[model samples]
Target: MRWFEIALVVLTLLSGLVWLLDKLFLAQRRAAHAGLLDDGRDPWYVDYAKAFFPVLAIVLVLRSFVAEPFRIPSNSMMPTLLTGDFILVNKFAYGLRLPISNAKIVPIGEPERGDVVVFKPPQHPEQDWIKRVIGLPGDTIEYKGNQVFVNGQPFGYERVGDYVGVGSGAEMTGASLLTERIPGRPHQVLEVDRLPFVDQGERGAQVVPAGHYFVMGDNRDRSDDSRFWGFLPEQNIRGKAFLVWLNCDSITNLCKHNFDTSRIGNRIP
Candidate 1:
């Protein structure tokens, strides 16, 4: 996807440059000559540039600022988001940003605890990972007994039942499912049986530095997030992942399609 982003920007720029140069320079030259030795036909490259420039530019702007689509390749967000789920991320939810660099150009909002976000992890900036915000800047966060504590107040959790994963998430079956309350929203998190006690001691209660956040996956035990890689830097955020638009799992593969239409349009909690 990063490669796709780079390709999109490069194609858009190349096409737009060709079209602009033709309109401002080559076109005028062709008109001035009229029939001198020319048949008044634009070059093939210019024709291609003129045809593709607008479409490429429109897609680039929309994807860079309005919204963008992403496919979940792992079960890190299982139950909330399944592997093969296609989600639409709100690109300007936190702020407007440049396309490839992801540098914020305008301020709109900050990530609240519990917001699902897609970001470049500090340890692996080339990959995009999604997780729920657990701690804001200056707040202390901890994970113990399969529950999250923020600022010394543990988040409310109610056991739902045993989880039953499907498709790519089948490995998570038999995990304990519970609803956790944070940032005024209630969302489910999974606690696997293999994990015993998760007492991080001093590391669990670490304070989130300014411009950084603590994030964790809904699949609590399986995710490698802030608990493993450290706090998420504000600059690494790509956008808020707010919606799951499609789910195309292995059930839909092997030359046959079995997309789960029911998961479509579900808002990420």
Candidate 2:
């Protein structure tokens, strides 16, 4: 269950082997040895493959080119995304790519500001992290006083209110909420007032170079993101997160139990 994508790929690859064996040996040998090829009907192996080949191929294509499902596992995305939210990422929104290798075969578009994206961690490519795209290639990103400035322009922000957690986030209930606008993209950000803002300024303002990006989580105080590791390369981008099909972490007394029904069908900004 952990490596669902890997399992899918393995199943798909196995189907190819089954298909090959049925064609090279079973198809020809069954007629001579079993005399079933004269029945004018398909053999058992052929029938079995006929049922599974298309299904496996479709899974491979959709997961690689069209879309993919991912589960939120941490509080990094917090208010915007909870621990049990099952999200659908648009694979082709950024471009089409081959799975595992993740090599882009077509260039459709690139990351834009405020996009909630799923990308391989900069520190560990094997691990995937979901965060808001803060800076694009060649964009200067500066963080000071919990405010973000992109390309020397301070993005506008308005304090919304204190955040209240209903489920698992009950302990962090009184966090600050701010509506942030990053040029073209605008979204809500949560900050824990109890935590110092010093961490954001711990490292000097960073200049994002070409082909690289800066991303951060909504839970600014708790997330282990670009501030901790570094910038993410364009190739590591998986896709943009669009919808949350299900969210169930709160019922089990989990850490992210803030059940915000308003966020259920909310489109990613």
Candidate 3:
């Protein structure tokens, strides 16, 4: 489990313990000594715990099962999600998992193609990454000349224009912008010059294994994704990104009103 998750669990347990002890034992003791000098006073730790228990419990529930906020640290999802974008992920969109353990106990819905998801990479389990789902279990995925194919059907792409990056993402300027139609959804993707159909350590086509997914970055040439590593295990999935709540450029530009107002309330595609 992550450090933040451990902290939440600890806080919740401590607060609950204090509350239970006070209700079952401490309260009776205090009542019996009503006229004593210390009757009206309670221990500092108990007071603090009682005051914080409700608030902590609420936060734990919300963050563990309702939703959680995450900050974008890389441009792998450029054109769809930019760096520094603070996004909210729907925790229960796929299912409900136990806090800390992350063991799914309730069945909700499964991820679909074209859904933008946040997950722990199979190779780097300690880090969290976000990408767009390209292929589901039992489906064959392929990439050739900057084009994507799912189960032998090529996804349609229409060249829109040259993409001009902004803020921290300016390094990707001049990439070709195209509208990629993935069945029901059409989203923009950036592609640099076409490299080989299969680069070193990258596969041209492969069948997605059960309980796994094939994902890729919108910035076709820049992302280190399943193309380079491997499939994303379903158990490692955190949640589906649904909206951008805030955005700010890097620290170097923090003083120039770096807040991106236009992207603040944008919905994640």
Candidate 4:
């Protein structure tokens, strides 16, 4: 959820509490000012809040439990997703869970091998990351010289020629565009020699334990992901990104700003 949504929830709760306190404790003083008898009763603030509290609480419940909107902030999932892509994440698709404290209250389907998932960073729960699931629980993942191996078998790959990333990702122009098979799933990934797989603090392979997943970015060298940090816990999952509502990174196209018609209604894998 965004900061504005967080603020709205906090303010709404505070407002409701204040109104309740005023009605329960200071009702006589408030009613006197409102030209009412000094009998312990509802205050003007309480009356107004009665109508507002339900509406605010409903919004909070629906947004936090039903569905949540998120924007792609980086090129980690590029070729499949780009920067500034506004997407909707199904908050309950994984199962219903209480907001803020992401404890899953219901059981749902687990993430697949090639699924692009959004979750809180294990290194920093405050930070959120989106990436492709490469290794599931109990899977051994190995990345050697740009090749990915899961359970000692290399994920299939096919060269798809050069990738021309527009706007911010233009730096990856002429990078090798390859079709990578993450076991049963196949997706496009970019490999740029100009951008070497510098350790950039990312090192080592991890043996995924039960209820954990190892993720990696499609932009192999550009993203700061599990390779650098670690696996994402099942509880940290937010949802699958499934759309690109809009993309307007450079100001040169402001007047023409709108949905990327080609990307609209596209299913995210």
Candidate 4 lDDT by residue in tens digits, 211-247: 8898888988777877777778998998766666656
Per residue, candidate 2 scores C-alpha lDDT tens digits across 149-215 of 8777888888989988755566558888888887777777788878665456336678898888999
> How much is the lDDT of residue 102 in candidate 2?
81
| lDDT value, candidate 3, whole model | 0.88
Question: Which 10 consecutive positions of candidate 2 have the poorest summed lDDT?
Answer: 254-263
- Report the candidate with higher lDDT, 1 versus 4: 1
Candidate 3 stretches with Cα past 4 Å from truth are 194-202, 251-256
Per-model TM values vs. the true structure: 0.94, 0.87, 0.94, 0.81
The local lDDT score (0 to 100) that residue 21 gets in candidate 1 is 98
**CA lDDT of each prediction against the hidden true structure:** 0.88, 0.79, 0.88, 0.77
Error of 1 at 209 (Å): 0.2
lDDT of 3 by residue, 1-269 (tens): 37888898899899999999999999898788788565487788889998999999999999999999988999889999999899999999999998766789997999999999988887887777899999999999988767888999999999999989998899878888999999998999988764443463346789999999999999888899888888898998999999999888764656267788889789987
Total backbone clashes of candidate 3, pairs 3 or more residues apart or in separate chains = 0
> For candidate 2, what is the TM-score?
0.87
